[model samples]
Target: MWLDKESQIDLLAYSPFAELITNITANERLNPLTIGLFGRWGAGKSTLLKLVEKNIEERDETKKKFVCISLNSWVFEGYDDAKSAIMESLLRTLMDNQPAFEELKDEIRSLIGRINFMKLGATAIKHGMPLVMSAINPATATLTMAQYFSKTKRKEILNDIKQVWNEKEIEEDRDTTVENIRLFRKEFSDLIDKSEIDNLIVMIDDLDRCTPERVIETLEAVKLFLSVPKTTFIIAVDNQVMKYSIENKYPKITEGSEDFSDSYIEKIIQLPISIPELSETDIKNYLLLLICELYLSKGVPSIKANQLDILLSKVKEDNIFVNGIKIDLEFVKSAFEQYDYTILDKGEIDEFEKMFDIIGKTSDVIASILKGNPRQAKRFLNSFLIRKSLAEIYYKTDRTFDYAILAKLMALEYIDMNRFKELYKWAIENQKNSKIKELETITNISRNDEELPEEYRKWSDEKLARWLKSDPIDLHEKDLLKYFYLTRESLDINVSVSDSLGKAELMVFNKILQSKRATEYSLLIEKLKENKDIKYTKILDALIEEFKKNSKLLKKMQPLYICYSEYRSEIKDVLKKMKITEINLQTATALCSMYQADKPGFSDVIKSWTDKGLAQDVLDVIIQEK
Candidate 1:
């Protein structure tokens, strides 16, 4: 069963093109009107046109009289060919709306026949005229015809055709080609008008894909052929491609000219529709729900509300300043699960973190691949998930939940293993800071490092580090690691480190302290706050004293403080409350006393007082006296 992944759905909802279609379709005027569906490639122009077509098809009988025809000009080569193709398409479309145009079908066919005959005659004359014309004038121009036409009785046929053309009225009409084409178009328009088809909606899709000449030709044909009342032509195209096509075809037409491609199309088309981008929240929620659905299908337990809350909390915590748009991962994940696929535990928690890290690190790379197109983003994520499943199968392990695996998956298109390893090394080396900022900076490092002078590189690194440590904070160690891995893999190193490790670490520590077991951490923080000089000091001294008093407690707490000095400020509030102040000094004193009991001095006295938790305050008073 094919599940609906986030990529499959309409992530960018409620497009404005729908309104333009409604207004055009609702109007009863018989005059021809044009609407241009404009945007960059993959901007959902084709999707919008298809949507409008579907909507119109679903309408009741009262609205059924409206004939909608969709065509693409790229199927033909050059302007003349595309124009003929369009004319043929119009004929077929008119026939399809048999209920409305049945009465005028014969007349329409006749007009088509006349145009076809004219084209055939023109081809034959061009090919067979040379020999017969040479008899009339020694230096007559040679004639050439397309291979599709038969070459028989060349001289006799040319003579007969010339004699027919030389007749009084035909000879008098010097503008035969132009006049015939115009007359044929008029007849076709008249037939449509008399048929009273209510409305004629011709939608041209993928005009951008057409050659420049063909695109202009198609546009011009629409302007000429559909110049009747109650007719509307909607074209789906990339504005840039259209502009380029026009400039290429008409080099003399300068940029910003009133006769620019879009402006010319706009003169015929009343509405120019532009699809809006999907908000980040919408995108996240959509993906989350899709993942949730996938998980459920894999027999994973339904994500509980609290679990979803936790997920959302993580998302919010990680993305604190995402345009003031607040969303929890659980909400996003659960919605995705229920609506599309579920995020089944295919791997361990660590593996999942790694995957998330990859995604976080290479967000810009992924964003670039998607071309800022939401549909592409959905496709990429869905594809990544599928690849992860395949990898799980191949490895014969449940590493799908392993964050590293996910990171690998997220970095599939962004970064290679070598680059990912470098990012990993960078993150590990800078573990003293919060994970978010580190990962973010690493992922978004400048790709143009070579372009940067040595001085600029140093300046940039310093500036980035300072910026990463700023407020309205963004830095998260895990986030930074993931972003670094993903972005580095994708080779997009232009991302800035928006927050610092200290801030993110503090936030996490604060949250942990705010939980049920708050006493120890809170007390440690308060003590540290009371002693200004105790900042960023190792907690070893305090831990050793506690060990002397109660070895069990010391053993229980040593691991927490082992690397505390490296991340002291980050976890200062938590450490201070735990009464773990002056750890470095206390450790130094304890070591000195152990080595020099016989050589007693202030260091010995200080060591003894600190072990008893009395030296810090006493020393403060003593230092003041000195």
Candidate 2:
């Protein structure tokens, strides 16, 4: 039900940690500070950083001098030189920011020119000089660029470097690397000094998610080139990852006196903050709120009329035992109570009460199995929602599942998958009627049963016993096939529904189907570029489905192709494999709109259009441009 992304709201009470960070960074006395926000993966580091931005903005509402730039270093890994990439990304973000930046256009342009020259110097060193210097003419000096930027400026930089090469002193140009770095630093500090801004906060997030080479390169860039006055870098990473990346980068930097990597970190990170793991109570409350939010979006108007701001703090009400854990239903009521009318006269109460118990009872099992990870908890909830929807889709009726039984079964599966599979096999093989008679005995029998077989002794585990003893008991009497139907992945399940997609993919698919504006499509294309591993066919099929059904949505699909060129190869390959002859004009017109002179794979589509008896001179006009 919940997408595994950073929460825009302070659900985990991350604002205090953010407040501490903002308190430190807001002071110009602490300028040039590199504060390390250390945490485990998915421990809300990104969310906490977002809250830090909020805190800074709130604190600076009167003056408005803080410029916050959020950058993910993992995006640059294996794609470009990390050092210049970070600088370039910072410049691009600055140009995009609208406040006092509009006045510094001249300084910004000069900075970009300096970076462009340094980029060319690094390229010449890494790729042999002759590749550029030997063929050092205006045409050949159009050096390769690592980014798709202003082509005119790219050519200008090329000419500058080409001019440097034509001076006939290659050795002098080689020394420009060190000289250029010193000049870049001086110019950067000068620019910051001349700006109207007081604090320039750059949040370098997901640094630990990058490869070791990128990790070293990015850190080196920050430490070596860009540590200027009135600037602060909030670096988020796992402690061990930073240490390990250092070890990988400098295996023998010292002669063994306590590791130079530690000293390196101690020097760069002036303040270290570690975000601790979630407690079981936090995990239970998070799942409960997610359930309420998920169900609220689906016809529960009372729950929506009220807000879910209860997650901002720990519930302090007296707790009663729901199954085995403490659940505060009174607090749940406070969240839903508006004008003193109880929710749906008891149906909503039962749903909320039941889910509180469902999440409350099995939280210990999940906390032990998954270490109470917030990301894993959200994933499990998403899995439960998908299976519930699949049950409805497979039955082709409005009758939904008994959410309690399905949830309990999924808890068992999450805690002990092997046990669940063995239970399923036993129901089919031993009971002979899709009934697990042994489940009744195993779930009920004592641990001291001397007559019990050794193979089934694991069912006596404490967590397993508690899970089975929870509500929705006696699975031995029900048809196991119906319960296992939606859980089975090998079934002929329909993937066109949201049930089959990940939380993010489903959201993207729905957006693709419904968005009618080119502006919205532009934003969607940017999101798609950020998430590269998303299945192209999921989007392609969504577009094709809409175009076939309504034919008006084709207008929405064309702009996405014209603008986003990063995934064009994958889109073309999918189209080539598809049978688009049935929708000839719809397919051919879109393909022709996307035609590029350098990019191939459109000939077949052109021939298909001709096969459909379209005009020949239309193709000729396109070919003439090529």
Q: Give me the candidate number with maximum TM-score.
A: 2
Predicted structure 2: lDDT = 0.64
The lDDT per prediction is 0.49, 0.64
Deviating ranges (above 4 Å) for candidate 2:
117-178, 252-258, 295-306, 310-327, 335-357, 396-401, 430-435, 446-453, 460-462, 490-626
- On residues 1-626, what C-alpha lDDT tens digit does candidate 2 reach at each position? 67766776665556668888988888989989888899888788988999998887787764338888889998888655677788978977787674657677688877876676344646555544323212222243343342323556445445556564343232322333344456778988887777778888999999988988788777767766777888899999988899999888658746665586787788678889999887766677667666656544223466453344432233322221122233355656654435232333323655656767776656645655556577788888888778867776776563544666677778888876546665767766754565566787776664334333433544655667767666667666666666676677632323443444667777787876676676786577546746765754346545654454554554555655565443344344444444433444444454456676323545665565567655555555434442
The candidate that achieves the highest lDDT relative to the unseen native structure:
2
Report backbone clashes per prediction: 89, 0
Model 1: CA > 4 A from native: 1-9, 61-63, 77-80, 102-104, 117-174, 253-263, 277-371, 398-626
Q: Against the true structure, candidate 1 has what lDDT?
A: 0.49
lDDT of 1 by residue, 1-626 (tens): 12322122222443345655756676876246777777776566666777677667666354347777778766666434466678777887777655677777788777666545334345444654322122212233222221223445434344444453342233322323333345656777787778766777888887887778777767766765555677788888877777787767656555655554555455556766766554545454434333433333333246434334344344445543245343343334444434322334344444444444444443423343344454565566766666555555655553323434343335333423323443456556777765534345433454333232321232243333322233213333343443343334344343221221245344434443344443555355335434444322223333333344443342223233322333222222232333434344434332232223223323443455556575454345423321
- Considering summed lDDT, which 10 consecutive residues are worst modelled in model 1? 129-138
